[model samples]
Target chain A: MESESGDKYAADLSSIREAQMRISSYIHRTPILTAETLNSISGRKLYFKCECFQKGGAFKFRGACNAVFSLDDSQAAKGVVTHSSGNHAAALALAAQLRGIPAYIVIPRNAPNCKVENVIRYGGQIIWSEANMQSREEVATKVLQDTDAVLIHPYNDRRVISGQGSISLELLEQAPNLDTIVVPISGGGLISGVALAAKSINPSIRVFAAEPKGADDAAQSKEAGKIIKLSQTNTIADGLRASLGDLTWPVVRDLVDDIITVEDKEIVEAMRLCYEILKIAVEPSGAIGLAAILSNNFKQDPISKDCRHIGIIISGGNVDLSVLWDSLNK
Target chain B: MESESGDKYAADLSSIREAQMRISSYIHRTPILTAETLNSISGRKLYFKCECFQKGGAFKFRGACNAVFSLDDSQAAKGVVTHSSGNHAAALALAAQLRGIPAYIVIPRNAPNCKVENVIRYGGQIIWSEANMQSREEVATKVLQDTDAVLIHPYNDRRVISGQGSISLELLEQAPNLDTIVVPISGGGLISGVALAAKSINPSIRVFAAEPKGADDAAQSKEAGKIIKLSQTNTIADGLRASLGDLTWPVVRDLVDDIITVEDKEIVEAMRLCYEILKIAVEPSGAIGLAAILSNNFKQDPISKDCRHIGIIISGGNVDLSVLWDSLNK
Candidate 1:
């Protein structure tokens, strides 16, 4: 089914299917989680896309694998460059290695050691930058120019967005009757793709976007009908720190039904609940949907009571062991 | 499927099947993991039955659930009682609640607050005892006499042994081709049940037991041809501290092929590997099998290369969040 909104938000199914075929062997078709405990607690049957079990410890692998493989012979010869705190860099490196292409990553100076080591272990050439999102992007751009490597924006590229949509494709296939879906939004690539795929498959399926209140730029942008940037991102959920991208802004605005925010404390509490009750060890970002539900933040909203089976993309489950202590203390 | 051996260790098929009927609806038929990530590193094809996601946070629930449900109508009308540091107490509470029966849990004075809170949340009556296991047990015995409530020995009971075997039954059904299997042993209920069910189903499949060296009374007992009580059990894996008992010891002797010991440090390293590579949050006990594989401690054992497929039961995924820091630092 072709999306009516065109390329701005609607992903090309043919392109996504092609990407899926190319990267199918390189990535895991991660399991879908039907958490009985969650259902019994929330009174809503939950289906979680367990991408924490995906290769490279996240769903980032899918987009990275697809983007790296989608490169033509000339682009492959030129190599690839990306900026990430951790998972995307590692994913791209592994994906590039599969294609025998060189990969360069610009990592934050203070990135978690476990995540930094993962990039080096996967054979990525890492360049350190100031421990800020702006520094990462600027260094990556400089590296791309110096090395003549093509830039692969982690969440802005069409191939990456289409690749991420495959998760929802799989989810809707496994659970065709899902009436509502919520996705954790960082730069909007994941939520944009998920919303597009979900709405296309079943237009009546309500698509929600959850962002950490510390970095709820996306929610603000959705209200303003344009991109909104924050001066500082201060959430324990390091993954959902970025504001929505220019390409993702329009898509999220047009396709997504609602954009909600969860406080940092709620995120931490949700992470602890996931560990204690589900025993799944979800990182802070991965627990936002659950946080909203468990905290009753979602019940008072426009989301209707008729939304029975809720499908939530547990975006990423990559947490540094160092963070676990801080979480316990909190 | 009944073991005609008539030894206290022998668990008949009817009892095992009855446990299945009792807890099947309440617990997750936890996923079985077969991954190249583990197999490639271990020099053996690995099949892992992840009970880390089990209800009440551990495989102890299987035994506790069964023991609670196995109570006679008259006895259940009274209540159930037991003493423990954590997991067993919580499991007993959950089990008794499902049966609409009263649960009196005698936990040690200084038991982890998280465990105590979980018991109370499940509608169980809490009885505080001396912090040490010795005093805890004495108080539990007195409570049983005074109350005439059934005392479900954490691991020494016949019903518990039968219930714990359900993991092996599920593993055999999922991966019947396995030639060797490993399980972490504490009170020996899990190993006793797994060994009986696995060997009974496929007699050629060798069943091995892994334990932390600090609390290796189970291994020592098997070597000495009798149960050897530990005056002071010490291990990072608090769950595997108890020694095997009369009922569980006989089954360990008759059915289990070999018992291997691993250091606490090795367990921590294995837990890290599981978290990083397998994307699973495993407690120290859950790491026993992988620890043996990582150390090459049992690779030279009689279970040769041709065993083809090897299965390990990751008995639980319940690590107190506070323990994560200790594991990471180790």
Candidate 2:
């Protein structure tokens, strides 16, 4: 796909570097944990960058902080608005509150109570929307126009992509010689940033994007040599269920080496492994990279030997306990 | 008990210090995690010493390494023997193997597969016994006699206590002004070592032994002024079910400031909070110290202001997933 059209697949990573500079201090340099047990089992080294311990319980804070804090004084006074399942809502709320700005979050009515409470606790105004893409987008657009508030899309924003890229910058700095990095892809903000950060540092570094097969829009898009919309997205990893957004799509299309798909069952197994062996509580989405690695999904399509020092990004830890409790009970 | 006998708990601490000097290369000085969330909720700065990330999956490695390396030329040839539910079993096996010594582990047949597999993988020979205290002890004794192996009791041995003492030594060194500490007590090795180390550094540093009410043998013995046995011990905390051992009770009865008992439900709740909030997976036994603090089970009921900087020893992270799966299921 890249060979057919030069520069078509490349991301505008210069903007992402600027985003990193903007929100450097607001978020944590979340630690990377290399799994000895996993390494031993696979006969290969495995480094896990744990973003599950991120502020507001996710890497969403990076993008949110960047988006909110980058606003002009007039915009800050006018407030900001966004729609999210949960993490992004809380992240944006905290981000806005820190800058002494009002945050108007449009959350799905069926969102988890803990998440809704987190947003409210952080002093964000909540607007309940129907739990569907059409309703959420429509309500967010209406709210944006009604109040003239700045709309911060969760992804599909150059600023958000740049903010999320900071994770890769830190990971590569910590494990500079890493050969391959596998990350869970949602709407492409994180992967776009990561792929750019890694490739920019060393062109040899292979980037693998992990997504649930049910939500394999990015993988399909990459194969089809352009964006391909999916009518249906089914996944336990709520974070990775979305199709790639417009701004994110071009970046992911050009930069990401490969978009890999895995079954949700593999993600569950990986989550359990993280809980059992790694002694870390990670959400299903957070384990997608691990799921890809451990499920032997990569073995059939082997990573090059230069990429022997593999790193996988664990995206977030805003896990729903009821689902985990149910799985544990079973 | 100490008043009548005029005998205070004293560890052969010189042995411990010497072991610390020798085994410094083998063990990790696990980091202490401080929590703003916990401090706010508990009204005290809680320093959690995470040993879950320790090699051999727990603080058992410290004791195991001390015991194995302390062996004379003759005993090293004969190898070492121990009976344990799991953590110590694997620790001793790995520690012994590292030194080219064989490990004979007598394990209850009912022990979880994860632990048994860890022990086996660490090159230990497992001698399965019936799932009863009598059978476990009897099988271990027979194995020791048959093999002429050195018996490294999980907690009763002097060297084992000394090894566990290093955790407190490190904690105190890391946070010097801490006025009080909470140590989870099982066979009492961890708390015994902790009490000795804390008192030696600063006699004013109050040390509390946090024991599960289900297996309140430590609490019972503290009141009885002698070692007391449990008729039936049932707790999700497999780590805290044992009574204070021979070497531990004397030390615990005297040097320790107080003994506090928390319930199984409290332990479970504390585990959940640690897993959820701290993004750390803690076994129920490891969560007892936090449980005690959260429940306000203290002498003054509130952790004293003098004990403003409180240290908690999370002794191990060798969690069994099946058990956790069952627990979280409930």
Candidate 3:
């Protein structure tokens, strides 16, 4: 009830509410979808919060929009800068374009052509960096210094956490009786925000983080009771390869009930089901939630045996199907 | 203001309204979706009526459910029968299953394995016939005679047309200001019902039929001012190959404003856009409406140049992506 005052790294429920109000007019209040056939297969009433239909085709737009709009007149005048090679780059670019400001995007030189095209399409200024975190951060820092643009970290900022947290508010209102929510954990911004907001709204609601076993940092972190960094990660889920941020790690460790890791084969199976059964195109990270729920580990877990009404957050739909098609055929 | 009475082949607005009331509990009020990027690409504000999300993954379920439930006690006990190798067979099977009655499906032996699985999944009694219309009809006739079952034509029957017409009522209500509606025409059932109901609601509203260029019987019939059956049809849109039936022809001849035929290439392109941009999986038949609007004929038409708000009915989404993936790769 105190709103977590004077906490720079934390985003409380009040902050999330404020972010929702600020970004309400800019983003779509995307619909919640359900399928009986899918329900019968998974043996749970799964309500999919389709952020895949959100602006820029991902939930990243929510945090980007909130961060860009929260700037003051002088801060806004200098523009915004971020280094991302995934949906966040396009989202930030589009959000800045909507606000009539320059977005200096520092993308790796080896980033996908489609992603680069998305940034250009949204009128973002592209600054190329080498394909590594140190090079990316250095390149982004140089751009921020040159343009005097404010830096918006992908998942570490309080504004971004609060923005992503808006999804919980909307999802709860859409499906009020959802006892459990499963969200994909990448940098933990999405799951951290979701866990905090959902638990704040209803203390009894359980939040679970879904992570690809190939990149199971979140699961390791939960088991160790501390943030775990992997030297190398491997997964088909391009979006869920990032390590948890300092700001998000605390929220994840404290609020998230459990982390369910799924294999790449299971994720591919879930993606196939999304295409054939649900008639929805979800990227690998987005389908991981469904994969986690259907995993044998979850089924065998005593705590999850009675979880009837579950919510799955489909994070994004920006995958290039040509690549997926080739892989499937092989 | 009087409802058309004593007409066995006709389905007016009132009939559609009654069918809506009768089948309201069974079918989904599928949402209408809008996309700004799609509007910018097509030069018109498009409202997509997502009947692809309807029961059985197609709008055929509506007509099938209406026909199955309209039967009297003894007729219902005898069961329902149909001959097809498409969404209709699966839809009819599901509808009959819902009513706890037997569904005698006379599917061609050459029908795709996925389609057969769908019918079997819905508990239909599959009867195999040779890969020809005459063979299908003959097998269906035998089944009807043996079981004393009522024949439910996929499109020709009044109950079927009335059920299909319910789409118009829902679409018009969802998008109240749509000045034009483009619907994919197969056996003319869907467009006939849409034209009748849409015109009844708003006399000046334009109804256009989107047909595949390879299977252009509807376009030929419009020019001839009479029904013209195709000797052989060829198109990627398997759903649009059926010729207009006698009952549906009259409605198309009197009410449909125009027919726009698009090539297979355009249909594939629309399907790509539906998957990549709309983030929805639409079959070739379902993508035809969007393809027609993007066609040269529709763009150059003087009547359509001024149309601002348009509604596109995505008919069905039962496509096998493995086959599509092969073709696209090739």
Candidate 4:
């Protein structure tokens, strides 16, 4: 499964398996947690894949570690670069730090202070850009040219997709009887990998994408039978504001069974539930899977209505207390 | 290992092993979690026994489950009663609900709304008393006389101590190489049970009790080699305000290594660390173990200065968000 750089949709079970083996020494095999209270709340037995406990406080570390370590010595010596104002930035920084290589992080000017601090704490070289996708990409491109460093696209790279797919490899074996998996959709790297590996291992396992209604591009794309870009997006789940990438979109369009959208308020409530009942701290993006399970969209869906055992990938837990307090207060 | 009704300190390794077997079906064998960031922060390898993920969102459930299930069918039909305004009350209610028996919880009038809600959710019959020990005990005595229900002392009973000791049994097996265990001190049920079981399994393992400076009665008692009662106590860790019971005092005097007292600010900081780094929601009482590990009292201790592997029992995760928010803002 050594995919060519140009192959956007090359990630499969073999690639995911390889990624797992490669990153096994670096990443944690996070525990699966269950709450009876949550089970009764959803009327379905739910198993939470606690990626929130992963290194860098998100599942992004798995992909980042795999990509950084997969590099040959020559490329590794040249270092790596990425433009991310979220978990991926910190994760890439940490992964590079572990490999004793420099990380060039291009962050948006308005990115949360806590996230920026994480990059600095991990020894990443900061490169500021205007708070726009264009500005971020332009800055990243300049950094790449100047430093002669390898660019690791957060969710769009084939290496990253296969790396994130490792989650499914561990999860399926942990909870072998899972009838379905609910994943939070951002750039779709997480869901792309999850769907590919889970379906490959168990063809009947339903894969549903959980999206914030404010950032409903994935839902629109699903309905339109193609990738639909949004002009504007709004969501409290900051990690979920990204549009689906070309590599991830094809997988979502083909493999993802359905897309369920939940409002920001629903996502907040899910976050609170995760804290109070499950005793697990989860960022809003990580809690969207629980929100989707409790949403009417999933409850009324004819195909998945009777799925007994459900697995929710809690994607990350890297939010600021002030931000969380504001959302909970609202 | 079975003790008579009047026995208060009959808990031994056999009793703890029996309790583990009896309650195995009802309680969770909580996972051991580790964080590299935390390890570096404290300059030691730390394994966290996540009792916060227990059935009632605390380790209290283990004892409550054991106490409730150890009764004969006739005694179970008579139900159980306890006077507690903390995790123990809710734990008892939930355990009783699971066993299909009535639970009479005598809560102080000033108990937190969230804790009261938990008792109500578990269908415990609430008997409100004045916010004082005398009133709580008097009301509990009346309830026992009227309903013919057995009284389950929160920490002073043999069954509860042995039940809590199951934690050490499981922890010793999970992290077999741990040379030290740090436990928070309240009424000393948790630490008392932990010390007994941990020392019995490995005589060389050191057991340290972590206490809040505001409620340093445990430290004073250890110094005086006798139980010491505080006229008043003040700490944000509402759970650790209780003094050691007569049954627990002897064990803390003999088997416990030392008592480390930390400030409320330290506990809050540890709570923040638990949420920020470990991604675990731990109450102030639960975070005290980490606080002690980071405190100068433990770090500078001559006896335990060189201990490598340490186990921390995170006692509970039942604090209100508003309470947590206020503490963090401070």
Candidate 5:
């Protein structure tokens, strides 16, 4: 649905459906995994949409591929540019590479070595930025202006949001009986897209956003009925530190039924459980949905109380092994 | 496909096919995972049959379910017994529990705490045995005699072999164009079952056994044309310590095309790769096939030379976290 402000960057169900067709061949239709242990623990049948197994090890690939492929020939010739030090950087880089297009990544100088290596491996040109978000965006804007490269904003772009919405299309088809879908909200593109597509398909299907307690701008935004920006954020789930974007805020506000917040300790515990029981190495951000469930963050919600079957989107698997080792050791 | 001496405990392709049908609903038809990174590293198209995602976290569940379900109501009434500290113990326990039958597991006193907990959690009665094969066997035998429980040998029995063979049936269907099937060998039940079924389906398909360099009894047995016992075996792949059994030896000799040995270091490296790139937690035993490929153990073989598509059966994921952490840290 279009935003009340009539913003050009608003995604609806039809746009997401188009995106699904556009990126079908370029992306993997990741498998849905189920574990009896996880089901018993949450007291509900949980279907895990394993986006961690997706190409580039995250669901970001869908949005990246869609954004890269949507560019017209002349527009694509100039290449694509993005500012991200997380899965989105690697994903956009790989997506651009797959399309035989140049990708300029504006990454913080202090970004993890592995993440930077991932972008480089995908043939992305790295333009170092200061560690702060403002500096990163400024560098990306300068590069876009200088090189005439297309700016593929991580979450603010309509194409990217629509691309991510394809997940709910596949998820609904995969598990038609799911009563609810729990998604991790970062800049909120994924959850916004998912909520739109899921609600459009099944209005009764509840969509819940799972936020890290350390950086809960989305939760606070839902409570205040307005976007809330955090001055500082701290969470092991580094991916969920971003505040809600303008484009995503409206979608999340309209379509999301509830916002559940889980602490860092809960995220780590859920990550450990995922590794042990699911035999899948999920990043802390990816395990937030499980953390929300385990922490009983949705216990009092009427929709969640009636929910017998739930679908959890595992956001990514680009975890630092040392951090995992430390948490597991502890 | 029967033993040369026509032993009662001999599994053939037909029996395995029957087992597949028998345990179809009881066991998960595990997914086949593929990674571009893994394929590039191995220089071959590798289809990983992830039995790590199987019921009870291993392929052993297929055999256990088949065995438990195959028994007559009268025979099942007396319950089942086995001696194991690996995936088989938990698999059998869960299988028996599904059938509402008692499961008695005789585990070595020094077995990993996690494994002991797994068996107990599955509602299996635990009988502590000394840390020796003979003591385990004696304790299991005594338990069977005292409780009138039928013994379900891990890898030596016909029923179990047939059940494990079912994996090949699924694997072949999942990746029908595989030129070679790589399996980890311990007592050789899995390989025997896989080889018999795979060869019976397509004689042109090469079946290779991946064994730990420290526990190369299968390789020695193949070379000597006799079942050779190891004086002492040592490897990070604890699941592959057992020597080839009489029932499985004949099948391996008749059907298996080659035996490839990999070092513990290679196994650990492959295990780490699985965790990192595949986003799956595979035990050292499960990673041996990849280790064999990575170590170039089959580089000279004509069959392997012609093999473009190789199927690797990930044997299990029942790894001790502490052991995995230590190995990864090191």
Candidate 6:
């Protein structure tokens, strides 16, 4: 895909391979988990790539580490910058700290207190932005102009996309016979990278994107054959409210076999199931893939019909306890 | 240790080693997890042996599998029987199912609904008993007499203790530099097995026991240098309410370095931290080891002064969600 400035940023298998080597020591090789109860319920063997256990409690660490560490000494002198709701901010901050560089994070003022604390704990300087996409961009741009810091776009950068692809390299090696890989899509970085890497390894392996019904821009974009932005997004999956970016849209359109949409209720139910059966605390965004499967949203896809062995990426585990408590009780 | 009839049922290093080999294919070798956040809070390096990820969602599986599979063909034909309030019942049921043997579980009518469901899901035939220890024992005896089924005592049996001891074998290999190991004490089965195996592997290694303050029989017994029984127990850690068994008392009295008691409030706090920091669902009993450390209950122990590297057993993750919600809200 080409950016507005006519810059091409495409992720390939070779780049992903290099990214894996780059972040090997920096990131955790999280375990692939299975539960008999989950298997029986889905009627298929499921392998969960638990990035919820990943360093920084998410897969965002992989991309953030790759982007921060890939910079040259001169480019890295001013450090990195990013605007995120939660995981990416903490990830970039930690990655910058590990590289002995400063990180400037522009976060919405309404972001969870725990997430804000996580970023500060990793030594990031935070700049509060008004709670909207445009305000976040404005604040990030001002920071960039004042500090000359390089912006590390969460899901739109080439390095970040390639870095996220490293998950497939590990997943494929961990469970080689997987017929379908389900990923929770937000700005589409995870699914874009995973699809490229998985299809490169085995063309027959299908990759499906799962998104919350409240923020189904990616699903709508896939059907319309172009990128579509949502007017308003409302879901408990706070991490997946962002719309698809230009860099990730082309990859999603060409490589992704299907997109599955699940309700907010389904996301909460899957979160509870992950706690009960998988014995892990997964945020709503992380559990959405399983939520789609449990809700039978994937049953309409022909490729998913023959899927005997499925792999899922638990994207992250960072949620506000109060919010979770309220939703679970409801 | 000997039973009242003077029948010996002691577990040695060799017996534990044998149990490891016998159940190697049946049980999971759960990972040893570390978190920098956790380490910073505890003021020491902590290695968590996550038995919560074990089959049947507890370390009880290892013991149950060992006991059920150790049966000779003639004995196997009759199947197995047990009465448990939670994990052990489900563990034995699943183990028996794996061996193609019928499992008869005598559960107290007041046992948690989820635990009862787990047992039934594993194909165990349930025979309900009145909600009392004496009633459970009588019902188990009657079932054994009527069906000719062998009883697999949860923690008292030699085979079960040996099986549970295998966790120490894996922990030692995974992190050989540990100076102390902390385990939750219930009937003292887990701690007894762990203490024996860890001390045998490294005589210098200290093994500590953690119990809820409301149910501190193990601590009382250790302090008195004799087995002590509690007439009534009160704690949120339902799994640790049982007093030390006769076969386990001698082992704890001789080998356990210290027993620390934590209040119910501390356990709930630790449980919340596990959810927030480790991103894992740990039941009250499973979290008591960390709870003890967090409460500073072990500060007076002289041996703990030299302990830099510590290992803790997260025993299980089978909690009632409604109770957890209430505790967390409070």
Q: Provide C-alpha RMSD values for all models, in order.
A: 3.6, 3.9, 2.9, 3.4, 2.6, 3.3
Q: Report residue B173 deviation for candidate 6 (angstroms).
A: 2.2
Q: Estimate, for each residue in B1-330, the C-alpha lDDT of model 2 and write its tens digit.
A: 132267644355566688788789888677666645577788888888878767766888898898899888898989999999898999999899889998999999877677788898789999999887899899999998899999999888878888888887788888887888998988988887777877777878999878888889888888898899987898878877777777787788778777888988888778777776667777778888888887756636554556688998877666665644444334
RMSD (Cα, Å) of model 4: 3.4
lDDT of 1 by residue, B1-330 (tens): 433366344575666877888878877787776655567677678887888778776788899988888888998988899988777888899999989988899988766676677788778899899877778888998888888899888888878888888888788888888898888888888888888777777778888889888888988998898899788876778778887877788778778888888987788878777776776777778888879766656867665555568888887776777655334334
How well is each residue in A26-69 modelled by candidate 6, as lDDT tens digits? 89898888998899999899999999888888999999999998
Error at A292, model 2, angstroms? 1.1
The TM-score values for the models, in the order shown, are 0.90, 0.89, 0.95, 0.96, 0.96, 0.94
DockQ of 3: 0.43
True contacts kept of 2: 0.38
Clashing residue pairs, backbone N/CA/C < 3 A, model 5: none
Give the interface RMSD values of the models in order: 5.8, 4.8, 5.5, 5.9, 5.5, 5.5
List, residue by residue over A1-330, the lDDT tens digit for candidate 2: 132245434334566677778888777677666556778766678888888777777788898888888888998888999998888888899899889988899998877776787788778999989988789999999999889899988888767777888888899888887889998998888888787777777887888899999989888899997788888788878887677887777767666787778988888878877876667778778989988876655777755344578898988876756643343334
Q: In model 1, state the lDDT of residue B257.
A: 80
Give the per-residue lDDT digits (tens) of candidate 4, residues A281-320.
Answer: 8988999999999999888899766679999999999878
Q: What is the interface RMSD of candidate 1, in Å?
A: 5.8
Candidate 3 regions with alpha-carbon error over 4 angstroms: A1-9, A323-330, B1-9, B323-330
Q: What is model 5's DockQ versus the real complex?
A: 0.45
Error of 2 at B299 (Å): 8.9
* lDDT per model vs. reference: 0.79, 0.80, 0.86, 0.89, 0.87, 0.88
Off by over 4 Å in 2: A1-26, A110-114, A302-304, A323-330, B1-31, B72-74, B109-113, B169-179, B198-204, B299-303, B320-330
lDDT of 5 at A174: 93
Give one digit per residue, the lDDT tens place, for model 5 in B299-328: 766567688999999998877676434433
Model 6 chain A poorest 10 in a row by lDDT: A321-330
DockQ of each: 0.36, 0.36, 0.43, 0.47, 0.45, 0.45
